[model samples]
Target: MTLEVHGMTEIQQLAGKDLGRSAWRTVSQELIDGFADVSGDHQWIHVDAQRAAAGPYSKTIAHGYMILSWGVPMFAELLTVSGVGRSLNYGVNTVRFPAPVPVGSRVRLHASVIDVQPVKNGGVQMVRGFTFEIEDCTKPACVAESITHFYP
Candidate 1:
C-alpha cells in the first residue's frame, strides 16, 4: 500500500497505528555471500557452509546488517505517506538482535508507528518500531525503532 500524505494532520494521525506486515523474503546463501562481499565480512559462520554446519549455529547464518537492511523496503510496504515531497532517514533510536537468522530461512517485517511530531521546515518526524521475524520461529531476528523526517 502506498502512503499518501493528503496533509500534515493526516500523516500525524497515523501515529500509534500498526502497519501491515511486509512480504516474505527467503534468506539464501547467495544473498549472504553478496552481503559478505560488499561488507568485507567474510566470517566463517556466514560463508563456510561445512564449518558452519559443525559450528554452534549448525548452519550458515545471515549477517546482522543483512537483516537490518530488510527494514527499509518492509517499512515502505507498511506505510505510505502522501503529500510529502521527500523523506529523510533520520536515524535509528534503538536496535537489538534478538535471535540469529539462519540461511534458507524466510523472514518478514512487522512495523508500527510509535510516534510523530512536527519538525522545523514543515517536516514531520516519525518513529517506527519494527520487528523482523523469521518464519516459523518463536523469536524475532531483529527489533529496532527508527526515525525518519518527512518533508511535506
Candidate 2:
C-alpha cells in the first residue's frame, strides 16, 4: 500500500485509526550487506554467512535497524490521508528487538494509530504503534512506536 497525503488537514482525521498490514518481504543477504555498508556495522552475525552458520543463530541475520526500517512502508500500506503537503519523522517513543530475523526469512508488519495531536504552525503530530512478525514465527521480530509530524 502507498500513503499519499495532499495536506495536513486530512491527516488529522486519520489520527487514531487502524492502518493495515504490509506485504511480506524476504530478508536477503544483499539487503543485509547494503545495510552493513551504510551503517558501518559489519557484525559477523549479520554479514558472515559461513561463520554465522556455526554461531548461535546458525545463519547470518538482518540487523535490528534494517528490520526497523520497514516501519514507515508497512504503516503506509495500512493508512493514507489526503491534503498533507509534507511530513517529518519526529521521533520514536520506544523500540525493541525481540528476535533475530535470519537471512531468507519473510517478515511483515502490523500497525495502529495510537495518538494524534495538533502541533504548532497548523501541523499535526501522529504516533503509530507497530509490531513486526517473522513468517511462521510465533514471536515478533520487533516492536516500535514512532511519532510523525505532518505540516499543512
Candidate 3:
C-alpha cells in the first residue's frame, strides 16, 4: 500500500524514512525494444538479443536509463502526497548503475525520502533515493537520487 500524507507539514516529516518496495516487474525484450525505439538507442547489447547472447552479460540487457525510468511507477507504490495542486519532475540529482538488468529479469524499487526543502511558489522540493534491485541478484540495477517539486 502507498503511504499518503496530508500536506506539506506531513511531507516534511517524511524525510529520512524508508518507504519500502514495489512489486516485482519483469524486464522483457518487448519493453526494452519499446524503450529503444523511443530513445533511439539501438545498441546491440540492448536490442539485438541474438548478438547480445554472445556479448557481455550473455543475454540482452535493458538500457540503464530504462531501468532508471522505473523509479516513478515504482515510487507510486510507495508514497503519495495529497493537498497539492501539482507536481513536477525536477530531474535527478545523482544516478549510478551498479549492475545491469538483463532482459527477463525481475526488478523492484526500494525507495526512501532523503531530504525535503521548500522551493519558491509554495512548492516543496524533495530528494528521493531509489534503489532498483534485480531480483535474485546481489547488485542493484540502479541507484538514483531524484528530485521533485510539489506545488500546493
Candidate 4:
C-alpha cells in the first residue's frame, strides 16, 4: 500500500519514516540481457550464464546499475504525493551494491524517507533511502539515496 500525502507539509512529516516494502520482482535472464543490450555493458558475469557458472557467484548476476535504476518505480509503490503540479527526480546521492543478484532471484525494495526540505518555487526536496533486497538473503542487492523535487 502507498503512503499517501496531500501536501508538502505532510510529505515533510514522513522524514525518518519507513514507508515499507514493495512486492517481490524476479530477475530474469531476459531482463538482464535486455539491460546489457541497451546499456552496452555485456559483462560475462551479467549476461553469459555458461561462462559465469564457473565464475564467482556460480551464476550470472544482474548489473548493479540495473538494480539501482529500479528506485523510482519501486518507491512509487511505497508512497504517493497529491496536490503536486510536477515532480522531478533530482538525482542520486549515494549508492552501494553489497551483493550479487543472481539470475532468477526475487527482489524487492524497502524505502524510508531520510530528509525533507522546502526549496524555491514552493517545492519540497526530499532525500529517500532505498534498500534493494533479495528474497531469502540477508545482504541487500543494492542500496541508494535518491533526491527528488515536488512542486505544488
Worst 10 residues of 4 by lDDT: 6-15
The C-alpha local distance difference test score for the whole of candidate 1 amounts to 0.90
lDDT of 2 by residue, 50-91 (tens): 999999999999999999998887777777766667789899
Candidate 1 wrongly placed segments (more than 4 Å):
1-4
Q: Write the per-residue lDDT of candidate 4 for residues 1-152, one digit (tens) a residue.
A: 98899987898898899999999999999999999999999989999889999998899999999998888898889899998898999999999999999999999999999999999999989999999999999999999999999998
RMSD of each: 1.3, 1.8, 0.8, 0.9
Evaluate model 3: give its lDDT: 0.93
With a 3 Å backbone cut-off (N, CA, C), the pairs that clash in candidate 1 are 3-80, 3-81, 3-82, 4-81, 4-82, 5-81, 5-82, 5-83
Range of the 10 consecutive residues with the lowest summed lDDT in candidate 1? 1-10
Model 3 Cα lDDT, one tens digit per residue, 77-108:
88988988888999998999999999999999
Better of 1 and 2 by TM-score: 1
RMSD after Cα superposition, model 3:
0.8
Clashes of 4: 0
For candidate 1, report its TM-score.
0.94
Regions of model 3 farther than 4 Å from truth: none
- Distance from true position, residue 100, model 1, in Å? 0.5
lDDT string for model 1 (1-152, tens) is 64555767887998998887899999999999999999999999999999999998999999998999889988878777677788899999899999999999999999899999999999899999999999999999999998988886
TM-score of predicted structure 4 = 0.96
